[model samples]
Target: MKRNVRLVVARLRQRLTAAGNPGLFQALRDGAAEGRSTGRHRRVD
Candidate 1:
């Protein structure tokens, strides 16, 4: 259905953002580069 396809597209967008954006998936690396700053971990659940 159309709604199902929309949901799939939204999920794909989230996956792409998480994978492509360093500020998102690379939080630990980013924090470390900022002189050991602490950041909240990304939530997957």
Candidate 2:
């Protein structure tokens, strides 16, 4: 079940990416990178 879910998600992501939704993909990738950077984002003023 878990593997199937992962496959489905991966396929969906690929289709969206192929569709040239760069802004949306970038938003998601940015959020993931931020989480990896510090578990969260730093404050900005």
Candidate 3:
């Protein structure tokens, strides 16, 4: 669980392309922001 969070944070950082930006942190704070679900078929939103 810890590793996954770290990886997600890393990817968020990599995708972040603004100077002195902190969008990634905000996104992380907003739980269930975006990600793939591991289960039966289902439509999000």
Candidate 4:
């Protein structure tokens, strides 16, 4: 199970690099910001 997860992560890294992102940190930050912006449109419990 751990090995499968590692392989998936490695594949993701390769794809991100191929797409020319600096790294996952920037991608995650941007995603978080996007989620937050969209969340403002919904009611929170």
Candidate with best TM-score: 4
Question: What lDDT is obtained when candidate 3 is compared to the true structure?
Answer: 0.55
What does candidate 3 score in Cα RMSD to the true structure?
5.9
Q: lDDT tens digits, residues 1-45, model 4?
A: 778966875777777778887566456546656768886423323
Against the hidden true structure, what lDDT does model 1 obtain? 0.55
The sequence of per-residue lDDT tens digits that candidate 3 reaches over residues 1-45 is 778977887777666735445764565444344434443233343
Per-residue CA lDDT of model 1 for 1-45, tens digit only, reads 778966875675578687886455355334445543434433333
Better of 1 and 3 by TM-score: 1
Winner on lDDT (1 vs 3) = 3
> Model 3 compared with the native: what TM-score?
0.36
Q: Scored by Cα lDDT, where does model 4 land?
A: 0.64
The regions of model 2 sitting more than 4 angstroms off are 1-12, 41-45
**lDDT of candidate 1 at residue 45, scale 0 to 100:** 30
For model 4, the superposed segments whose C-alpha errors exceed 4 Å read 25-45
Best of the two (2, 4) by TM-score? 4
- State the C-alpha lDDT per candidate: 0.55, 0.69, 0.55, 0.64
The C-alpha stretches of model 1 lying farther than 4 A from their native spots are 21-45
| Model 2 Cα lDDT, one tens digit per residue, 1-45 | 768967875776798789988677667657757767888743222
Instruction: Give the number of the best model, judged by lDDT.
Output: 2
Clashing pairs in 2: none
